[model samples]
Target chain A: MKRSKTMELGVGLFMLAGILGLVFLGLRVSGLSLSVPADTFTLQANFANIGGLKPRARVTMAGVNVGRVSAIELDTDWYDARVTLELDGALEGQLSRDTTAAILTAGLLGEQYVGLSPGGDPETLGDGDTLTDTQSALVLEELIQQFVSNMVRD
Target chain B: MIPRVIALGRHGCDLLEALGRSGLFLAQSALGWPSREGLYLWLRQMHFVGVLSLAIVLVSGLFIGMVLALQGYTILIDFGAEQALGQMVALSLLRELAPVVAALLFAGRAGSALTAEIGLMKATEQLTSMEMIGVDPLRRVVAPRLWAGFVSLPLLTVGFSVVGIYGGFLVGVEWLGLFEGSYWSNMQASVDFIADVGNGMLKSLVFALVVTWIAVFQGYDLIPTSEGISRATTRTVVYSSLAVLGLDFVLTAVMFGGLS
Candidate 1:
């Protein structure tokens, strides 16, 4: 009986430790959250070409991360790449209607992200509002082609 | 030529017979519910399988992480992307190495022991005595160990990944002078919970089931002799290790081989 008691105690501690490790992996290592932030709103932008933009990529304002790219899909009506940005609720009413959204890379070769530059317009963009002014991701091949064509003309 | 053909056919039949028996063995040992005493037996087994293996898992995980960071730092520095070390280390450990390495170690540490213990019991006719006394040896002997392995391995894998990530942090940030904030932040940004960590846990779960099944089945099905016990113990380790590696490839292809 005494031996069984100690065995039970040891097993209980082992189980606890195992569970703690899993919880740590989910929360800390993977950065998963149990609850979504209550204050978040989505804004839409359309690009001629988004290049390699993926969902969950960062959305930055002046190089500071503000939110994430929640979704990217084709705008069937416009034949353009449509991106949905889930931004912090605090900045919901601060962005102007004419704000420019550009697809930018982090470094010489890095993952692509969406960068938002606020505009001079006083009209605030609200939930689900679409940004009209947008710049497509820069393609190196196209730039090279244009440079070669200009050189030939010269 | 005739003798060679006969030998080939005989080995084929033996392989089929063993495969069928193991299938039935898995079903019998895995499907039944445990009685009250059986619960204690399971707890005891968990203590043996999980607690006993923790030290090796942790120490090896730490060293593996440190080595990865050092090697990744050297390579990434050449590309001027040394800051991506955290993302590289976390992804590699969470997605691939931790679960695979932990399962390999579990096969060696606990799987072989389970086989030898059961094999020894059979050799001494203890299992036959249990049957003579009306206690089902399959329920009393095999089920608890199987359940213990199933519950223990994923936990160990998770523990391994957590320790390994910190080990990388120790080397990359503290020793190598990479900024601490970017190391963690970059990892957080790239490592998805469902895609990387969740798939890793699933892989360990499958490996746990396969490894324990092979261990117990090898022991129960072996000839009751000293030499037989030794052979079964060796087969448990080798078969489970091979199974873990092969299954990892299949699972990775299914989980991450996205067309898009």
Candidate 2:
């Protein structure tokens, strides 16, 4: 049986539309971009606790996103959490050697992200430089526990 | 009491027999590549299943997304976290709602149609006639429909998710006065492509296989009467919906449960 040209055209259009939807989801929705900007650099920070800080979580300076947490692992030698931050290359040679990296929560019960505060050191940090002065994630439950214990003792 | 026990045993046997037959049917219809003519048949069936169902899927996706944003905003506003509405809506749609709901609609729309069409052909002795003419109705009829469903469903699911997310954006950003940049950026930050979107696609693929198999098998195995066709058609919708919901729990647990 011979089908009409219109039917074939409809199918072709439908398939194209579906593929376009998939591409939109990939690029626009999920942000699956293939190209990485050439100037991005990586920095490492070690923390006593990361407290739900995940890869791809934002790294901010003065409440503006400058990078993302790229990887996280436990350092066997130091017994602390090792975090890798992928920063925008545009900020290269700006961060001092003594910059403080702290894990901060967005809202009271919200996501955990890294907050970087610049230091007074004239020496600039480079790619893969480890931030020595770092503040660990604040655990609310631990704080409550300490408060209860101190109150009982008093 | 003994007669009732015997009846129960017979019903169990009947169910097992049907299950075995459908498994065999799936094996027969799903294997092997399509020849040139078979490709044309598949295309025609895709028209029936995919193209025809597009409007309903898109419309449902849009409304569902809008509703999700509205509901999530109401809840998140109490916490002063309404900015997370975009993330909530996108995650829920991509991870759960879009694929499952689209499949349920597909089962109701295309699955029921496939069952009825095949059942009517069987009732009219078309399948028997093909067999008498030395043509395997399984190859000529069933395979095309099965392949069409398998290919069409995943594409439709993607379309549903994309439309649904924008629907959320419309409700959350435009109507409700949420920040547009935060809406998109929060979604982009939280919803990982491989974890959330890929898992949803995987769920839809499995659903496509099960739903189409149930639709075709119920029709092919029907008792070849007007009442039988109607019963099979109803069964296709009921069974497909139940299977989709049930399998969703199992798939969610495996994919996102992080059991380890």
What is the CAPRI rating of model 2's predicted complex?
medium
> Which runs of model 1 end up more than 4 angstroms from their true locations?
A1-6, A147-154, B1-6
- For model 1, name the residue pairs that clash: none
Q: Please give the lDDT score at residue B160 for candidate 2.
A: 91
DockQ, all models:
0.66, 0.67
TM-score of chain B of 1: 0.97
Off by over 4 Å in 2: A36-41, A62-66, A76-78, A88-94, A107-109, A120-128, A141-154, B1-8
Q: Cα miss at A136, model 2 (Å)?
A: 2.5
Residues B207-260, model 1: lDDT tens digits: 999999999999998999999999999999999999999999999988888732
lDDT of all predictions? 0.91, 0.93
